[model samples]
Target: MSVATGNPVFETVGGDASAATVTPTGRTTAGSLADLAAQVVTNTTDAGTAKANAVSALNTANSAAAQATEALSQASKAITSSSANIAGGYAALDGSGNANVPGNMAVGASNSGARSFSIGHTGLKDWIRFQFYTGTGVAANPDFVFIGMNGTGNTDGTCALQGTAFQPLSSNTMTLGSSNNAWSGITSQTAVDVISDLNDKNIIGTLGNATYADVTAKLRVVWASISGVVYTLKSGQSGRQHIGVIAQYVAAAFKAEGLDAADFGVWCSTPKKQIVTKAVDGQKIMSIEPVYETDGKTQETQETIRYAELLSLGLFCEKLERADLEARVAALESKSTSSTAA
Candidate 1:
């Protein structure tokens, strides 16, 4: 029965709203304040599940990233320490697990008139140091050194040496050249016969390494310095290119799940690029930000979630520490729910 405005003491209800009924179980109601509590609990439960799922996904990504990073590291180490042959040469290695070169290589010569010598190691690396010298046994400049791969089947490797011209060798050993900027086009080579031939002619050039490993380690350093990952970004364009690539992968996953492009509120733009939220106008849904804020705009929130994830990735990618990342994700998920409740 329904209660009227004039009825204050009448009770004929057999439903959950009955106050006179005494039962072993708790009373239930179709419309009560407890429903709001239940809704809040449900939303919280959903967020919790989403958070757990996100953390799981992040863990997967991080695990993959860690595997990739480890693989790269192993590759680098192998390049430095592999006894495995490349183009008929052994892997150069040093005492500290670093790669090195062979011994008995000479650097400078006491001859006059544009003396150029080539210094290199077998396998593992391609560039060499070219020392210039003059007559009268005087070094015009010990700071000028040339680096490049020796061309095959030619005198001094097709005369591939750069000519900046310098003085003669003072001692019989090589010295540091200019510390300014190094020359490029060093190319790539991995032939033992060619490198050994260079060494036999006193063109191998003497280095400071006491052992073959030290020599190879030094050569590896030069190689990385000459060739490493670099980038340039356009004006107003954040360095989101890398993230954009990753996000594209994320987007494909999102679409595969059949998520609506509108109504549910999804905003994924390259950082620094203008963000446009998607919305619906009656029956017409456009994939652009509404011109009018009062025209019922989508509620948006910029979170540090990605940042936390990134930091987590950076911290655990190279190493194997999942506990830390899990803790951080948990804290973030807690904060997100707490804020929603507030």
Candidate 2:
């Protein structure tokens, strides 16, 4: 191609050219094209540097791809149910880094219906007991009662423990029921002691610290009110009439004398009563209910006579009356002897 034509065609390699006349289609002459040759050398150096950078980038991309493949393999193994290959551990799948919990632990029993907390040993005796053993064995016949909760399939859902009988830690200390609950029909051989020691007394005296005359006065008032009556019996008892003084009359007699019958311990007064919820009854008005008794149609406090106090007072009154009669007889005999001597 000619440079004078305004559109020059690229020349083939190893061609000769004369830069002095500016004809590019001919081979470039070495002596006349000094500045162009220098530029070509500089371009060759730049091309070599670019090729080296491309090769280095390709190696880095290949290494990253290999690392990504290895990470994917490890992640796949970690989520599996079996941990045989993951971080060299044989355990159940766990989120914790330590592979598994430190030691053996079981949340519940494997038995079909073993939902309730169960601790049993075949070597032990008949009771499937809940107890703490302090390296001691073979306790004697100690009274123990455990609360039994019957759920789902039971007819009665309520629990009752009838009396305050519990011994803690010791074989004797077994809690039978909650407060306001009682469990009866307990047959045990353990000895029960009623606390009545004389040492327990703080200020003990004869007949509630009453003087001899005071006792006699109380007994005389009580005897005057005792008018026995035969009244028709209730259905539970036989038709025979029962003889007893009205509790109200005794209370009235004491009131007339300006004294509180209850303070005297002659009238026993019971507070409002409560019947525990029965296993059969679904009605539970209160956890501990109050059932009041009716004196006629109106509610009234229940008061009963304590016959023991009354009987003791009567005996003392009889002794005093006998002494008075003996003294009268001795005086009468002395008078009769003096008259006979005159």
Candidate 3:
């Protein structure tokens, strides 16, 4: 398209430059081109600034990522350290780490210059305590004395010495039973000695050659030696009944092994009473005697007859009584038959 002007124009023969000078309404000027060049430069500068800003943001993001990775590594190390401490604490409490505590261990409330190692139940009322004294004179030893306390929470607990053999503390008495108790074992040497002494003193002549009449006469002498005196138990004494024949009487009766009814009758004639005294307490106390070697004449510290001997004597007496009754019946029947025949 060509611009139109009001000025008259001469028609140019094909491509001729003879056109009158025409003033064009629209034309490109130097100032407008300059403005367009400035706009292009401004756009390029803005695009460059935007690209630079994007690059800067990418660098900032990379730095942030690096810092986060470092922080995560530090946190992992801290967690591992904390876990190790926790594991150590657990080991200490359970005796898994310390050799001093071979089993379970617990620390009680601390007192001045004192501490207690406890085992068993955690309740303060019922626990076994290993107490170490820090005072003077034999207290510095780390070996603890064992103490057993119960929920009663009184001073009525027991303390034992810490040793290979568990023994009660000094001056502490251990009772076997609340009342009567039984023990099974050979009598002690001291008891044997006491019995030997008694046997020697109460020696009735041997019954080897003695007839039934002689046995009866010897038993009388043996019975007379004992003094039977009835006495009441003093206050605070054990309420157990003390009923037993004198040891000498039982011993002499045992010696009359093959006695007839008449001899047994003499043996039974001995008065029954509290003939035993405190002096013969051990001898009369029913117990099995220990067996030992003895010379023929001397009463050595050897085995003597026990309660079973007394029982045997009792059986003998019963047999003798039964034989006597049968004999009396036979005599009576023989008399009746003789009378009927007459």
RMSD to truth, every model: 43.4, 15.8, 26.8
In candidate 3 the C-alpha lDDT for residue 128 amounts to 71
What is the C-alpha lDDT profile of model 1 across 1-342, one tens digit per residue?
554433233334554543332222233433343454566699999999999999999999999999999999898766433344343446455558854344344454433223345355445245556664534546566444565665553444533444554435664455332112223224446632212355456433233334544543343332222212234445435664323223333334335445321212222432221224344443323233323234445433221123333333234332323554788899999999999999
Q: How far is candidate 2 from the true structure (C-alpha RMSD, Å)?
A: 15.8
Model 1: CA > 4 A from native? 1-36, 39-45, 48-52, 55-66, 69-77, 80-342
Candidate 3 lDDT by residue in tens digits, 1-342: 243433332222234233223322353322233354566799999999999999999999999999999999897766442343243332223336533433355564432223344355544665576666545666556555676765454456655556454445753377332212223234444643212356456555443234454764444444344344344445426564544444445545446554332333232222212222232423323232322235434322311224444444445545555676899999999999999999
Residue 241, model 2, lDDT: 75
What's the candidate order when arranged by decreasing lDDT? 2, 3, 1
Worst 10 residues of 2 by lDDT: 125-134
Identify the candidate with maximal lDDT: 2
Supply the TM-score for candidate 3: 0.25
lDDT measured at residue 115 in model 2 versus the true structure, 0 to 100: 32
What is the TM-score (0 to 1) of candidate 1?
Answer: 0.17
Whole-structure CA lDDT of model 2: 0.57
TM-score for each model: 0.17, 0.39, 0.25
Regions more than 4 Å wrong, model 3: 1-240, 252-305
Alpha carbon lDDT of each predicted model: 0.44, 0.57, 0.47
